[model samples]
Target chain A: MTEDTKKLLYVMTNGPENPDKTYAPIYTAALSAAMEIDTSMYFLMHAAELLKKGVAETVALKKGGSLKQFINMALENGVKFYVCEESLRDLCNIEASDVIEGVRVVGTSTLADLALDADSVISF
Target chain B: MRTECSREWDTEGELMAIINGCEIPDELHYYLEGSQMTWIRLDGENATIGLTDPAQTRAGRILHVRIKAAGTSREKGKPVATIESGKWAGPVHFPVAGTITRVNEQLELRPVLINDDPYGEGWIAQIKVTNQAEVAGLLKADQARTRFNEIIARDNVKCIRCQK
Candidate 1:
């Protein structure tokens, strides 16, 4: 929360369909937050599906852990979760009520603002 | 014993409790509330801090550790170090508010030392306590053993030390 605190934005484009790619963003985001960095994950395109209720719960990585576990960890570590409003409505067919409790339904403009403000922008 | 450090401790000491193969040395003070599994060993006004044995086991093999520089002042519940292991990543919160006096720099090159000797070489930091009362507020070894016993059963954790 300090002026010098670094901001990191993770742009997630993959979803439950790509279970392997889903965990890294959340895992690293949680770690970054633990490091006292201002960390956020912006779920866009297929990645927005991960914010849908019951989606992360059903997706388990090949390595024998559930996506829900990492998501919860990230949430507990203060990693901000954001779901693209456009992607959720148009591409994912997810209503605001269908999204998980912790995620914020934000617009593309918010993502642009976050990216511009961030010290690093990583895409998954 | 898994390592020289553990072997040196009096394994049969009356203060030590072996719960599910994890040693809880009652001689040290513990911060077992929530998932903050840290211990404080007081030496005058300076307190030595480290992750508990069960903590290292749960985290699996520690891969990286980044501790705050010495002389950094921190409040209670703030992290003195951030640890990343094969299975987990999180902050190692200090029980007492103080200024950092020392950090285990050896952990940078040999992070697995935490898994090998959690009570010894795995120690994270030392702090010159700002509040001596906070140091006393930490759980004693006996209380920590009772609590950790329940936690180990609930979490189904079996303490396993890595051969280093």
Candidate 2:
């Protein structure tokens, strides 16, 4: 597809539970912002917790920036963040309304459709 | 150039060796070898690129291959794509500046192609080169081998399974 029409999808499977292990996803989100691609981020499974506001600040990875900063950078850059509903209810134990501001809880099917339709899908 | 003993084999039983110190099977046409990594200059005006055999061998079987979309301009040493193997995910940087022209769809279903045939079916992205002159800056086969050896020596990177 043309550059103007390209849609970059950032899939985050890592959550706040283990920041060190999940650093790749956070870094990928930040890197996507830096690249300025027409980007969108989907937080699935444990990754949904990253939308919990304060949770991102607590997770850190070696040689990488803080999770909070990464998420914030993405949001600031207009990176559309979508939290998986199943993860929000099952893993994070929080309802959709409890999610941080500017984040939306989307269904699994939507995530799947986004993945299938995106020009590029990056899972971290 | 120099040839190393075969460490891996294909179904065809063709003897594969490390040429110019890069893990490129002798069957492929490799114009640039022995630099920090193996790079293929595309047959078209734009250069389609991917990692060399030695680079893929170092990465192990690729589990995921992420590429930037077409028309996206890229700078040298910046990540144009990311590849995952086992538990490690690393970025693939371009050796030259260019605008990405096309990405390989085959990799989405078969990431292992990077291991099975990195230089051939495993080729990654094609770029509409911004500066053709930068091609001269790339390393030759012999130089690439020396550079690969140095990098391997410095990093002391072992195969994923060999780490244990």
lDDT per residue as tens, model 1, B26-102: 67999976668898898889998998888887777788999999999888888889888634778888798999999
**Which candidate leads the pack in lDDT?**
1
Docking class of 1: medium
For residues B92-111, could you state the per-residue lDDT of candidate 2 as single tens digits?
A: 66777788888998999987
Please state the error at residue A44 of candidate 1 in Å.
1.5
Tens-digit per-residue lDDT, A41-76, candidate 2: 898888888787577777775643366645654565
Error of 1 at A90 (Å): 2.3
Q: How accurate locally is residue A81 in candidate 1, as Cα lDDT from 0 to 100?
A: 94
Q: Candidate 2: what lDDT?
A: 0.65
For residue A115, give model 1's deviation from the true position in Å. Answer: 2.1
Clashing pairs in 2: B23-B54, B33-B144, B34-B143, B34-B144, B34-B145, B35-B144
Off by over 4 Å in 1: B1-19
**Interface RMSD of predicted model 2:** 8.3
